[model samples]
Target: MNRKPSTIPVPVLMMIGIVAISFSSIFIKWSAAPASIQGMYRLLFTSLLMLPFARPYSGALFALRKKDWIMLIASGIMLALHFLLWMGSLKFTSVASSTMIMALEPVFIMLGAYFLFKEKTAVSALLGMGIAIAGVIFIGWGDIGISANNLKGDILSIGGTAAVAVHMLIGQKVVVRMPSYLYSLIVFISASFVFAIYNLLMGIPFFDYPPREWGIFMLLAVVPTVFGHILFNWLLQFVSATTVSMNILGEPVGASILAYLLLGEQLTGLQWTGSLLVMCGLAAYLYAGRKKGKDIAPVLDNAS
Candidate 1:
């Protein structure tokens, strides 16, 4: 008889990865670079950092099929767009507004799966999504009614959320057929090309970024983008999108705490309460779904 390998629980891995990714906002804020410049460096540096590990010329990256290449490039461009929009949001609106709105990416994913892909959703997951959305609503309310001056930031954040949703859906389809590291390599390489072209067209100075800025950018590429995403992509091998979405409840909480500690950003009591509600609902959803054993949703196999 063949033996199956025992694996670490997927939820634990997802939690850790999501927590690591949450630190990204803190690093970006600390860097204090322009959003476009930050977006450019993020892809460029992450590509360089990951290339050594992925060994793209070892026939790994090129081994992908034509269709896979298409999806990989699309996902990469969408990721670049997400980074650009969300980072720009920082300049226009409060962090609370941006994080809260971007948190709705999962909701968009759920909607897309239902309408676009015809994937079935569990009642528990739906309920959890609803409760989590309420928490988001409260957080958004807290951040809203600021000056109309911040409207551009709010719009950018929403656009970022849409980009994120598209990226996740496309990735779910692409990742199963290839190793996550290779998939990430293709995506990052494509995104770097897009950023390079955009920087050239905009006449933005892409080089000679200060050393301190370069150091921060390097940390950003290594820590959140490389480590966090690698782990998250690995978790997808064992987990469902709903499971991943549930884990996202931690991002805002982790971000809020880090912001307070590192950036002197304070959270109001209401925001804390809202954050807690998000966690509770996500916990309930995951628990209920996993108990049924049919928790993992069906991903579209055709993309691979």
Candidate 2:
């Protein structure tokens, strides 16, 4: 698959994608609804917006090989769980802690590769993972650190991060076979159904959300889904995957800033230190990719 440079300036695309993805945590916080509901409407609206473009690739969706179907379904499930778990964490934890926990993602990806794909990490990367985890412990353990609720949020955030990493892994397996938009469309719609089923089983009301809630839902769809993950995925052909992956490190910083300005949230000293440590460790882990000649593949946006 021969790929050309993006017609748009790559830095401009990077800024747009980073700023867009960063708002995902803020959007989730803006909503008063369940995470499943927010994810449902976000992905559903995303699917609708893609319908115009999807017509061309709709056939490929059906023509997927059996392995592709399995991969797509598993990818969809992981994506759904990622949102459901991660967004829920925001209710109980500070945006700083939650996003800092997401910084553990590269660690999860490395571990996943070791177990699932038999990939090995160098000692340097392993030490980096340890530093990052210790940082997250500080983040999650701020003043009143032993609060069970905060711990629950931290756990949920970790689960969410791991889920999305698996989503990316499964996506790595099948994405090359078809167009990205088509694969995304199939996965998003599948995730929508997962939320739908969950809502039904949990007896959560649907379609009764107020107008502002509806607006937030659409914002989640457009801001993060379209402008964030979709744009980041598209940018892969034009830039190094490491370039794109590194921009994701901005989420903890960006989201924390947004949280302070919009949500009146302030990070404790420990949280600030943890946030810095997380970035340093994850940055080190990602650069190790250079030595191995393998960057993390394009990832699904978890903050989204």
lDDT winner = 2
The sequence of per-residue lDDT tens digits that candidate 2 reaches over residues 10-91 is: 9898888878877888988989999999989988998899879878887777788998898898899999999899989988
TM-score list, all predictions: 0.79, 0.92
Q: How displaced is residue 301 in candidate 1, in Å?
A: 20
Alpha-carbon runs more than 4 Å astray in model 1? 1-19, 56-60, 149-154, 231-247, 288-304
**Residue 42 Cα positional deviation in candidate 2, in Å, after optimal superposition:** 0.7
**Per-candidate clashes, comma-separated:** 0, 0
Measured on C-alpha atoms, candidate 2 has an lDDT of 0.83
lDDT of 1 by residue, 254-287 (tens): 6777777877876556565666666666676566
lDDT at residue 214 of model 2 (Cα atoms): 96
Candidate 1 weakest lDDT stretch, 10 residues: 295-304
How does residue 8 of candidate 1 score in lDDT?
Answer: 71
Q: Compared to the true structure, candidate 2 yields what TM-score?
A: 0.92
